[model samples]
Target: MSQHIALLGSTGSIGTQVLDVVRHWPGRFTIAALGAGKNLERLAQQTGEFHPRCIAIQQESDLPALRELLNVHAPAFSGEILVGKAGLNAIAESSVSALVIVGLVGLAGLEPTLKALYAGKRVLTANKETFVTGGHLVQPYLDRVIPIDSEHAAIHQCLKNEPVKAVKHILLTASGGPFRTFSAADMQKVTLSQALKHPNWVMGHKITIDSATMMNKGLEVIEAHWLFGVSYDQIQVVVHPESMIHSGVEFVDGSILLQMGAPDMRGPIQYAMTYPERLPNPEPKVHLDFLSLSRLNLEPPDLERFPCIRLAYEAGRLGSGATAVLNGADEMAVQLFLEEQIDYCAIPKLLEAALNAHRQESTPSAPSLSDIHALDDWARRFVREQANPLTARSTG
Candidate 1:
């Protein structure tokens, strides 16, 4: 029997790859529901192909256009159409599927993910921010949430059935982005195009930027802390430009286990979708071409250049609303940098200021969902305010 699943962010980089997986194993998966943000054309194409029982859009304003597109493209789709956050939450809570794939970006993914877990649905998620911002809420439901990110998924594969005590530490690999070889002076002048040109993998703009700053790896470190029951110190980041060895685990006995494959998100997405069971992949599979490859390099990350990683470690250790603030600040900072409002170098500065401000404020040590959301909002505002002066100086 095919497993039924609901996919949020159905038109994204992860979502499209997931669809590719579904196409590969036609009878293995079913799309019960689909959700996306501002990409009605692609969403409609997916709906036409998959014919999910329900569909969701990010804004109410996109509803009419979506319906028209559905009419032209997926005229046979008689399913329900839901709008905004409420619609997303409804899909997460509904019984349309037993598994929910969260491809939604940023903080928008947190509530729906929480809702799905609470409603007893297993969640296969690629959204690192969900864990970075609200890992506390999701931690109790760890049994049901499977990570779909390549790094965490690689660790998940490596650590399967291995005793926690046998482990020494887990290593999360980083591609080191486009600026890995760049000097400190070179980093200050990097343009948006340069930052988005990732060396190994092709991803969405937001994540691509995060990768350039090494903040994606930083966020993954926080997620790994929550996904696997490990301390911040137990997780190490090695700059692996090849991206072939997704991640690894070292045992106390000096043995190491690593998961290696082509730099493809589909491999992890498929693993998460059909876990505990390995199935035959579609044509043009993802695997290492060691015969054609040469050497893999590993180096320590430069903290002086990419301070986001250092900031993430500090926030994860602080343990309160700090991680939430860290994620929120980075999201806004990345956006400002993408929009040319701030220099690439200013991303870390904005994040540090937000974390500092959050520490000084009186906040709950054990924050509720509301508290996390509030802190996220506060951090965004803090980053914007901090970036304004920089924007002014740049314009001047």
Candidate 2:
């Protein structure tokens, strides 16, 4: 049975890899809809190739050109759909698709993800912000949420067939970014280019910076708590300089299960897209022989050096709007760091302030999608107003 897919953020790194997976297993999947943020050329090429029923672009200004391009080949193509409120609904509610891949980065991906889940579409998710900001809104609808991130995918695979209660702990591994060896005092002088140079992964600018500051691990910790019904304490972050061991699960019987592979996004992406069944693809193979699989090292994350990871665990424990604040604040902080509006070390300080300001709403009913949006907006504004250079201190 071919799975029909609605791929939101079709122009992104993860989104493009998803298309690669589909292309490899042509008979196994179909693209029902495609959406992207302002990358009209790539979006147009995807639309032409996939012949999806609907396509969405972020900017309304790009619509006219996209529509004309589409009309030249796909004559029935109307104006390019804008992916605001309605486009999100359209992709989720599209009758043709069985699964929606929500790969949009940052908090922007949250609403569309909820819409897809609530509309009964299985979601292959790569965006950490979706769960970080609004898991409460989407948890009730999680019968179909599949993880596409490698670490989460590893956990998912390890936990299969095992009772959730039988799991003793989850070990979420990190590559420790480019600055794994840098002391806390040295991080203050780090440049943007230095931070962007990730040691193990090729990712977008925002995520690369997040990984450098260990904020990516922080976000993953939040993602782990939601994906697995585990407490914050049950989830552990270990810095594995080599990215080979994606993640691990320790059972109650003291047996540890680990998933190891080359650091490739397609492995997990393909798994989520063609789930419950495996398909063959000629992507790069994980060769343990020539690669020298000699040693695998694990160390406790240096929370003093990487406060963002600590802040994430704190927010995870608090629940409520805490994750929303952490996610929203970090998003803005990362943007600021990238723009040189703030120094490299200030990212977590800003996130910490936002988390402190957040007041947990009482055993609140499942948050509405709009409620999450509002909190995200509030966090961004709060960080911008309160973040200061002096507060940015060395992690040590």
Candidate 3:
């Protein structure tokens, strides 16, 4: 009785690590389907190995090229091919997979997540943007939605068999990224390569940038609010450069329970894939001698230095539409920065302007899917429209 898994974003950092986990356990899990972006070569390789019953591509124009690669690489792949957003939804709604892993980045993961939950499939989500944007829509399905982010996964483990009411606060640990010691003046001149050099983990470029700005932590804050049924005030961000303590829960009785592990995405991926069942690590990387450890410094996140976190908190508190705008703005701003169109500091400024615009516009408290998408579109456009002015101000 193998558990079938439908993995979206099959070629991403998280998706590849998930495959590593599945590869370790022979018959425990199976890849029933795969949904990938534009990496046909890697997708074909995965299809050849995993032999999923169905596969999806982000663009229809890539289908012929994908088929040619599959013909040469995965000649045995007879799986039904699907294309575009419809294909992603088809994968989510497919009857073969019992669990769906939403590994796709940004707003792309939200609809498929909803489809999977509505189709009675348990969803293990690594995409924080889903919750940040559509927390209200996904609230009723919280039991079916599992968090794959390291911080949320750690807090989920700590709260097991524990009363939610008794929990006082959630202390999510951050690596403080590569810019922890960087002053405001230093950050103004931060290069693209410098921002991508995350201190602890290797992740996708978007997330790596978010980490550098501490915006990833901000997104996690909103995500934790939805996943754990907690308020913004109850969640605190602690800058722990070591990343040893994944996250912690403080109880009302003055006791704190923490889940500590090596800096690895596979740890949480494996845990979510096989919940309530802890298995032996296939390959242990770091062995810790707790008594001989020298230093584990923990401090508060600097709101002034990393204002993205502040923007995230304000957005989360504002409501659904604002969070959607924040996420959309961040995505566009990150892209602009990566392309050298905007400096690193302009990222947060764009986000702030988008949030302000969203505040001025009339927004629904509980927006529908269509409404979320509309808000996302507006935010991206707003950021693009404002990027030039922000960039000039930052550089001039």
Clashes of 1: 0
Cα RMSD of all models vs. native, in order, equals 2.3, 4.0, 2.7
Shift in Å, residue 348, candidate 3: 0.5
Best of the two (1, 2) by TM-score: 1
User: What is the clash tally of candidate 3?
Assistant: 0
What TM-score does candidate 2 get on C-alpha atoms? 0.92
Candidate 1 TM-score versus the reference: 0.97
- Tens digits of per-residue lDDT for model 2 on 258-295? 98888889899988876787765438564435357778
Give the alpha carbon lDDT tens digit for every residue of 1-396 in model 3.
899999999999999999999999999899999999999999999999999999999999998999999998899988799998999999999998979998899899999999999998899999999999898889999988879999999999999868679889999899999999998999899999999899899999999999998999999999999999889999999999999889999999999999888888888998998898988775676544577658898999999999999999999889988898899899989988899988999898889889987898899978899999899888877888787766645654
Q: Work out the TM-score per prediction.
A: 0.97, 0.92, 0.97
What's the lDDT for residue 247 in model 2?
Answer: 98
Which stretches of model 1 miss by more than 4 angstroms?
283-286, 389-396
Best-first order by TM-score: 3, 1, 2
Ranking the candidates on lDDT from highest down gives 3, 1, 2
Local distance difference test, candidate 1: 0.91
lDDT of 1 by residue, 93-171 (tens): 9999999999999999999999999999999999999989889889999989889999999999999978778888999
Better of 2 and 3 by lDDT: 3
